[model samples]
Target chain A: MWAFDTIFVMEGMKMGEFKFISTLASVKASEVILDALFVIAIGVIVVFIALILLTAIFWLFGKFMQQGQKTSVFEEKGVNNDTSSEPHILPEIPVAEAGISEEVVAVISAAVAAMSADGKRYTVRRVRRVVNRPVWAAAGIAESTRPF
Target chain B: MNSLLQAIVDIWNESGFVRLFTLGTGNNLWERIASGGIGNLIMLGIACILLYLAIKKQFEPLLLLPIAFGMLLVNLPLGEVMKSQFNTLVPLTEQEYANYLKGIFDQSYPVFEMNGQYYWQHFETGGLLWYLYQGVKFGIYPPLIFLGIGAMTDFGPLIANPKSFLLGAAAQLGIFATFFGAAALGLTGISDLTFSSQEAASIAIIGGADGPTAIWLTSKLAPHLLGPIAVAAYSYMALVPIIQPPIMRALTTKKERSVVMQQLRPVSKTEKIMFPIFVTLIVVLLLPSAAPLVGMLMLGNLFRESGVVERISKTAQNELMNIITIFIGVTVGATANAATFLQPKTILIIILGLIAFSVGTAGGVLFGKLMYFFTGGKVNPLIGSAGVSAVPMAARVSQKVGQQENPANFLLMHAMGPNVAGVIGSAVAAGVLLTLFQ
Candidate 1:
């Protein structure tokens, strides 16, 4: 049998004798230390490399995010929709009258007027008030915690 | 009247209480305690200490309580809760090994046959704890536990700042360092206590600070050491408050600790949904061994983020997670029978596990300093210590220490970036080890 000075191979391996090794025998002291060092060196490198790959992928994904922002801008400008030739026509949204105080409406109108002073046209068509707690909040769940 | 009195006295002499306490058959309390051995007593004492920590101190009580109770149960005399059905530990003769295999695998339902002769057996069905432990032995509970963790994790912080992945990768220093420490102990000349390569691998994983990963890796690499490794991993996790702060303070300068980070840009919902799928593909393709853990974790995250399966996601996080945690705790606890637990190797594992965690924390903080210098002090080095993979606990410690330095600084969100990254990092480290060893 092939052997080293401190090696004491347990009974499991055999020539043409398929036996599984149940317990791993200890190696020489030097060998153990060296093997451990080798594992640490290689393992650390592997971890960094794997993470680096992930970072690169995410960076690439950031480029796609910029593109998505541009796409949303186009949609806002009616460039990617059926109303591209008719910005004044205004896409209609169905609405129902909602409970709101005149003071609240006046405040919203003032806020919109302040923004429109820079020649940006804007409109406020409807307002609504929430009277009851959401179902999740009533059931003792928080919105921030729901996803987790 | 005399005949009736005599019959009653005979029945009293044969009662279970008399059998239990009588000295004649060696079933008395004194004899039972003596036969239980010094190891059994020691383990029982350890179990009691663990229980006090778990119940009174609330030290990861969900897992520690079950494990300590399991330890207490198995160490008691005459409790067959952890006894094996067969003498599998002793060396079996060639014929005996064949017979043992035949008994378990053949069509004979708890019996073995040889040359038209039959013998009754219970190889597949042992103690109740043994039956429950199959979930651990076959590597079932850890992945299921990961599913729950997945459902519970919010990857938004990690997705918001993907560079936190590097800090997560850095904290795995504990696993590799402890591996070296365990092997180095072989030179100490304690033959019975020396760790083999496999044992060292298992012990080293205690530093990963991820309980499920530690258990899963132990079940495969060093099946016998699963109890101590799992216990060490979870105990250190609960002790995060005690262990991580000192290391974090030591590694970073006052200026580095006080560096306030800029707010991370908001991540889109599409990015959150794509994060898990892309991670699953990249990790599994690169390291197939990580599939079991990383795959399940991603699947759970997908269930949560997909929004279509809220019920299933909630069930995974609550009911399924709770059930598996109980099984994993009790079964892993039962593995620490007095005979196996009260050994020199177990003590070494405990000590080395602490060192591993400490070193891991330092590694992450030091790496954070490097990132701080590179980024022109934009990143706080204190949050780097959260890279040790103890989840929100490590992250919270970062926040606590940061707030102490600068009352206005809030590092919770910033620390969470690396905190969640550490989870993926440890899982990846585990994959690397499993791939290497397997």
Candidate 2:
């Protein structure tokens, strides 16, 4: 444990006052231990306190932002709900007929789910293969766009 | 023929080779050693090894290569690449006039009258490296580097999960713990091993795991220890992937490591823009001593997030960053010339640095376990080790280690929160140390 008296003595001292006990040779072993402990306590406590304050501030900020986002989402949903009169229909594509594996369809659906905001689930309506570009061009595009 | 022979001898005597081998007109082995030739040879050897590491091993080559080259340049005998410039007042006399006429002194040397006495102000120019080193010495380059880092860094992760800030703060345990370790080592009472509190603080900052912060704090607190401390700090940073994993794995079980954290909520554009500004105001208001490093970093981040200063942000992260990196690297390396570097204390500093890094990693992971326990294992303890700020490297290490346990786990973004938070934490820690010591 750190000695309170040492910290009190240090508190009253101004800058450069610690120069006297800067080196261990000038002070007793117990005093050096106490000084070092005091430093450790203060340093760790201050860092934690500062970061905790930041955490609290940002947590509140995050909550506020989330609330704003929720409000906007609700407002957008209200308008959409009021305007839509027709029944929504999904043209379910048969995986075997479309020449796509069940796993591939599931993967595509999962990707769509991942990208969806508000966690709204949507059924996969169809799957189409558009042969618009050569394989080399596709490879080049993939190569160029790959994340670092 | 005799005159020509004498001229050839004069040229030989004036050459760096003569200075390398002989001392005060003596050419004995003892004289050569006494003349600092042997020390320079050792330094050159060390520089070559560093060069090999930078080139072949690819250990932080961008900075290490320049640093090694600077070391090589400064250690060359009679190179005077780091020598200081000085002006001397020489009394104008008949002999002095004769010497000047004979070109012994530069003909351009200015002559002036001082106290009714005529004098020549003979200016001796400083070394090239000495001028460049002033950027590092005066605390200029580190903050500039931080500006570039700020521009590149995405604090969105940190902002999205603010609790990661605690892990960041926890990672700084290494620094203060090392401070205690350093001070405790002083209790050994060995004459060569004793370190002052200032020296301990400088050495302890290596635990911050941020090179710029380490250099900034060391330059301010213990300029003499800058060489070894910078070398140790960067070396340890490069070793993060290797040094961190063992500690990370040891601290957390496979189950804890595999615990996949939920993806962070998407931060709004307004929130992203406000993050840096809010951080700057709070951090600077609390610790004004951190203003230079933290303020510049936040400014750079604002440049990036604001999306208005695209050109300036690009320059900060790319071109300006490169130039300052070269200058800071070479000049800081140049400081490691024979006298200051080849000491027992340097070894202790390196050892203490490793301890600081290890302790910091352990501290972050342990704190993460506490979070995991409190949150009922929702927080993967593996991401805690990323709290030591080595940027994406430490975070990537967390991801890699976690993936080893469970391939589906993606902790990179989650780990990034603490990773960047570690940067802020270290800067704040550096400020606290500076306030206490400086």
Candidate 3:
């Protein structure tokens, strides 16, 4: 942020008092060129260092996350292999009579049958409305007063 | 009855209306205009032109409109709307200079010595706009604007491809280039067009192409030039569509422009949350001078990403940003009082600012080309021009130019990487300069 406190001190001096005052003030083409080149070199180096540091840090983080995921996957596989020794039991899930149109259900059932390769008869279960937030609300726009 | 009538007439004679008509008084309408002279008329015309550009042309109307009105309001005769205070511009008299030097070493003396003698004539209490200008004059508004920008900005693209940071840094070429250019102008023998190092540095930052950063730096380095610098920065930003395309085309071949970049990996929510914090830590530690801008920006981003402060994030993005923007625009405009803005140096600043922006664009594209060559055509050079820190605008220009080469080439997301990086880079540049000067 720009602060006003420094305004008084800076204004009291001319040209903000450059460290290489004499060379810049004289406006000698060669000297000015040298100073500018020096500044560019230093500025570029500084920016590159800061940005490159960030890049390296993020790269390392990505690697660490990947490694952690790999370890978790291995642990999950180990648990499943050990559990395979026992008989697996499937729990029955309760079904509800959902209010779906007969014709729509028939169409959906037929499509699912057509795509099935093993030819297992399936029953059309239920239909429900998907209650989801609108895009504006999800994006934190309180109401639907958005122009677009 | 006659005595009462005489008393009434005496009261009328002493009123403001009577004072306005009195030819020789300071409040006289004619004398007020006369005091401002031809410079005031030119500045008024300039303000009108700015208004036309803002209202009709729609060039950054959110900012330009307020700025133009401020310019118009401050330049009018007898407005008493602005006063020349000791900003970075006004040259100190010999006595004032001595006192100023003494004040630096002598803690007992006030920072400003002979303040009355060095200052321009105006009302003792200052004018209405001057009061409003405190936000800008004291350097309070820009950081708040940065907070809003932070809440609004998404760093996902920059985080997805950290390499864009180099492009962002490269885009600051114009700033340093323009600094040299402004100093070079001093040797041209036009006394009115010459720039002090401070003025040149402030003017050079116009190339950074970020409005708040430009205004912030100007307020610190050359507060007097804030009006022109802000106008030039915002105007060029608005003109990005016009200014950037040709430069992008000229810099890259058709094949280079048509090159399709690899899809960026999906950024996880955890990464998004950590990005702002990591950046704030890295940047502030590297350059503490950037703490206010970079820190506030990161804080705002944290607010948005944390998902815990939805209300504050929304306010920061919308209400707070809008309010500060209005104050910044109008108050900054008011600083362009006729006497200061009508000089030849103002013209030089405008010209140099454009040059700075152009050079910055070129620098980014050139760096992109270098990266492309190294990466074996993996990076599209077109996205490099987005490094000038105009945010979505520069990125859009890159996409537009790339599409012209290949109709199916959608470079927006890829371009955004450098685009957002440009913002960080420019702020860093400002921090660097501030550190150097301050």
Candidate 4:
């Protein structure tokens, strides 16, 4: 609301008192040129970010048509061996299910293993780390969890 | 009666104004015309028309009503009606006033010793409008208005569909087109009333249907032309309903306007929270010149978004906006005092203003149709026309027109996407112009 008072105070003193302060006032042109460069840079960034947003939008629309494919994939899984029968195995889900790359999955898996290195069969910290996993993947994992 | 006449003669011996008007102020009609007695009456007639447009037509009544009245007030000879007194708290002196107008000169004034110490004083003019005009002049009011605008605006829709940014950019086409129009008029050698690339560009921005940006930019680059530019900008903004629908109807077929857009998804609270911060950070970092306006707007949005600073957010929306609007209006009105405003270029500015607004609407709507073609009838082309930032007015026009084509179409929510986007578009166009000019 009140940004002008600084200009007033700076004006009240001559050079010596405001020696350090006057640099900003002196570099007005530089400030303006810097402003333009900054805007261009930001525009480039916003454009890329907007593309990311649009991808998310398109991804949302894709979810509707993929429902049938999702059910069939689960059906196919029922005929195959249950990966979870091997207690040490963590089943691999498609990238679409988790919205992450395989590399991101490995990094997450390593982090969880380190977090549970005390050798507890299952750890609460490990569970919380996996909670934000996509709903489809979470459902797939939940289908056969044995109640304690 | 004879004694009363004699008393009047005695009182008028000091000043002949009353007696002169009583005896008919001038012999010839032309002489009275030269005296501005007729000019004031003409100005009154103009003010009356403006009042009608504001009240009966409801074209930006909040500003137009006061501005029209202010016009009538200031036009009267030394009107006691609008004394334009300073706030009771601020004190100023003539020496202070003179010293301030000497600003550029003051920079080089002198380093002088007073009792073995040196001091320098900055120049600042305390002229009534010049002082307040400082805010208008250096691009201050736009952002302050933007702050109010930000608080009042709910970015939920834009956040819901972030891709609406395309519509906003599309609407800015009018700014570029008006530049050519202004240049063409300038080339015709019209009445020493030529627009510089800067001035013409600034004046043409009134078509964007954004008032504060138009005023802020015009005051900076073309301070002389601000009166007409501001009035035209606000007037057309108010006229969004009246002006835009014809082009919309003429351009679209019944099938086109009636195209029903799907219902907008409900945006999450978290999405709304991230939007202002994200958009502001991106826009301001890119366009720091736009930062003043974009920054303040984001600040106000942050207040609303964080869901914590409700009071400040409310104040920014209501009290702050109202106060600055009043100041923006009155000072703008004061600048229209006869000497500055009574000119041929003023009329030219008004004519160009209409052109700018019409062209802007055309551009936005036409682009919407193009998008509709690409989207295979999913997008209602009528909403495209409402991309002028007259806010709900333009949005409502889209809805009404679409309803005429198909009563059940219900494009209001969709039209709002572009309506709000137009605000950003005009602001960005204004930024581009400011960047060029500065």
Candidate 5:
């Protein structure tokens, strides 16, 4: 901006009549224009420095974007199964025509009721449970009958 | 009096309906209707190309057909039908020009005091495109139209592969590149041209290959260029399959195109459900200007992924997307009125836009090739070019070109990774441009 206004000043134009710059700011003389240019340069340099820093941050984030996510399928599966201790049931409603017996239902319900020690009838609900226990322990535990 | 009535009758007499049934035998309706002025002749030629692409080529027919038809109508010069100025009436000489021929001035539109004659001191008026331009100018309809866009987008793929955000950033190379080029080109003493640096940057961002992002950016930077930039962006997006394949083929050797990539891992619904919320919060808080686009887009994705919002999501994807697509397309097409669109600069705009797309494609693919070299052949080189947000279109072009090279290679799934990434990359670019330029 100062360089431009100086060229005009060299040509004998009045200080206030600097018409070439964007209609954003008025210039009083070459020195004022220099001051404005200095401020603008500092502002721009600060912005560029900020952007370069942001880029480095984003790059660091990108480095971790896919880290630690590359374990083999088989090994992960073995560890996952070993850490859970419940026979997961599908969320679908039990079909009566599929030979689900009333005795079995009653026994399971009473076992759960006895364990809970509550007054309400026991019912199966869909819940994602991840319990840590030995596989045999999960398989052997009977849902005992309980009541409040 | 009969002559006056005859004139009205004469207007319809030449109507093909009259001659068709009565005179029959010889060719009638189709022949006369085909007679076109020079403006229409050009429009028809362009329309024919679009028709061929839509019907025979099966390229984006839904949008191309209507847009082509609208262009045909606008250029036909059928008197004052698609009127440029709404107040353009043959100014009624109210009380007989008996007051000594007042004064005359070329004072364009609605001026109550023109030359000193107050014709409008007794009358009222409006600008034609002004009413229409409002929907384009005030950033109203496009964002509202975005509600539909937000409803339609599937964020699952993007969320499943968040690293693709890099590809999105890569795709915006054309926007910044074109902006610098346009700044150099500058108006440079073109009087009627009134482009702010931001305005020029807005128009240049259309190169990013994403329409909504282009619109979002344009609305912020240069509202005047909205109509042209939008029409161009969507038109080119529709043309992606045709426009990109040849370039892809030209750039890569047959063996390079055939490089196979490993299949993507199974994406879980749990991951998908969490994706939109995380992306929205991070991107919006970080770059508020990008919220209108990234926010709405993520919202749409959340609706689709949350599973519980299935009903609302379904309506957004289907009804909202479809309705807004039509409104946005037509309103944009209508903006190509003759006066604004007919200038020499428009051709330059088209030329520069194509360059922008090509550069963006090349930049992404080149970056991909670099990664491929570094990874020692794990990454397929063809997927990089699909890093354009034209969505499935750019990806499909990459797939087609890859198939041509090896005939056995299936690069579609791999290409999708970059294709979705390109969308995010362009948004990030938009955010950067907004932060700096605003």
Candidate 6:
């Protein structure tokens, strides 16, 4: 029985040795260089492939998102276009033959008087409409090109 | 007077000072060196030097301080903070059992019979560090650290410019190159200098220039080399500003460095939210082994971008990150006990780590030059060096170098694209290595 047990233990030890050799330990000096090269080529290639795939996916995703933003911006412009297409209604301000109306001048002077601080009397200045980009378009540009 | 003198003599005999000066008897020089106190003294000195670097030089001090203190704690004689636990079987007689029933013997250990004999199973308690080390041993802490990093990072720049992903991939050249270099070192026929494939993989990851990723991969591939590898990774990462510039200058022309690229397009909030989800799906599908690190990172990023979990994101970034950093730092440092770390292999690892960092930086810059050529001088090659995933530090180096050439140039946001992309790239490379080696 003791002899049988000793043989059993020896077999177990031999099996363990075999397992160890089959693993990393089995790579001989000659094969180490080849193995390292194999790992480098495969590792670099795999990493590049993975990242490149990500680049393609995200690039497409960016395009899709940009298209969506453009569509939204156009929709906003459509709303502004609808408002602009409506009939223009000029405000009721009586116009003189050449100069400004007296009623408008009186209203402007009263407005200036309402804005006076320290209770000092102030003169009415001329008012003019400045031509600029529409509010919606300017807002869209600012939203799209906001810097970091 | 006689009793006092006797007490003093007894105390002196029991003191660690006595143990420190004692020489160990062994059959061989290596064995004697390990068993004696001199090795521990040398380790203590090394620990002190690291402490000086961490404190005075501010070299990644948040983690380095705890790691150095842990090393100091472990090397002190009689401080069994990291001792291993084991169970022993003691053969017990029937009479001893009866005495135990009568409370004559201690009953803390249970008595049991195996075969024809009765034995007591005595369990020994392990040290404190041994318990805390389970997080690293089970590969838990690094992923959690990734989670915090994800929460803190903004992937907007990367989303705006996807080509940066290629630069990220290119920077990993150092990792593979060093793998071959380390394995080829074995051809020199120096027995101690040779490395197995796993050791080579672990050392090569130092080129990734990511501390948590390096730790995560090392713990899996080569746990024994964790101490030196972690130290080398963090040291090189801290030295990124110094190491990357010259390589960037050497690899690119003055005009290429001066190229001021157009600003990156604004990334929408919805795109930012979808990015983490899609990246997680694709990366995990490609390499399931990387799921832990990459998944946790995405989850943390999701927590930030989803904007619904502000509380949880804050906790992951602040409290949870700080706690894990402490646990990982100290435990990883404790692994550098003298017997394992005092080998020639460690010095080699340190040198190879520097080479890996330099090569990785050069690869990124070279790839940047390639992009500059292909794009008809639209791309600034300096930003390519930021692809090594040292994060904002690498990006800042790009910005600083570009400013030196053209003060009007701002590459911080642009370089951030590749900087963050490098994080994902290294994690992917880590997954590939784990697949091959693990």
TM-score of each: 0.78, 0.84, 0.77, 0.65, 0.62, 0.83
In the order shown, the candidates' Cα RMSDs to the true structure are 8.6, 6.3, 10.4, 17.0, 14.2, 11.3
Residue range B1-438, candidate 4, lDDT tens digits: 999999988877644233223211345664444345455566667778988988998878888887787676666654434343343222224564456557533455343445644444434434454456567766777789888888888776666555565665556666666665665553344534656656776777887788887887787777877777888888888777788899888877778887878767766566667667766666665455566766777777777778777778888999999988877876676566554565666777888888878887887788788888998888787777666787878889989988887776777878887787677666666666666554
Single out the weakest 10-residue window by summed lDDT for candidate 6 chain A: A1-10
lDDT of 4: 0.66
Runs off by more than 4 Å, candidate 1? A1-30, A74-127, A130-148, B1-35, B85-124
**Regions of model 2 farther than 4 Å from truth:** A1-8, A11-26, A82-148, B1-14, B18-35, B92-113, B118-120
lDDT of 2 by residue, B1-438 (tens): 999999999998987666555333235554445346666677778899989988998888888888888888887878888998899998999887778668787658787778867689888899999999999989999999999999999999998999999999999999999998887886676756878778899999999999999999999989999888988998888899999999998888888998988878888888889888888888898888999999999999999999887879989999999999999999988988866776789899999999999999999999999999999999999888999998888999999999999887889999999999999999999998998877
- 1 or 2, which is superior by DockQ? 2
**Docking class of predicted structure 6:** acceptable
- Give the per-residue lDDT digits (tens) of candidate 3, residues B1-438: 999999999988865444433333235554454345445666678899999999999999999999999998876656777754433434456776676657643343334325455532222466777877888867688889889988998888887788888888889999998987776665565666667667777888999999999998899989989988999999999999999999989889988988988877777789889989999999999988888888898899999999888889999999999999888999899988765675567778889999999999999999999999999999999898999988899999998999898887878998898898888888888888887665
Displacement of residue B327 (Cα, Å) in model 1 is: 0.4
What TM-score does model 2 score on chain A? 0.55
What DockQ does each candidate score versus the true complex, computed on alpha carbons? Answer: 0.27, 0.34, 0.22, 0.03, 0.04, 0.27
**Candidate order by decreasing TM-score:** 2, 6, 1, 3, 4, 5
List the pairs of residues colliding in candidate 3.
Answer: none
lDDT of each: 0.79, 0.86, 0.79, 0.66, 0.59, 0.86
Clashing pairs in 2: none
Give model 5's DockQ, 2 decimals.
0.04
lDDT of 2 by residue, A1-148 (tens): 1121122245566533553433322456777777787788878887888899889989999999999999999999998898678676767656444567788878888988886653556777777666568788998997676532
How accurately is candidate 2 docked according to DockQ? 0.34
Best by DockQ: 2
Clashing pairs in 4: A39-B286, A39-B287, B100-B124, B100-B125
Candidate 4 stretches greater than 4 Å from native: A1-148, B1-37, B79-132
Tens digits of per-residue lDDT, candidate 6, B287-365, equal 8988999999999999999998887998999999999999999999999887788788999999999999999999999
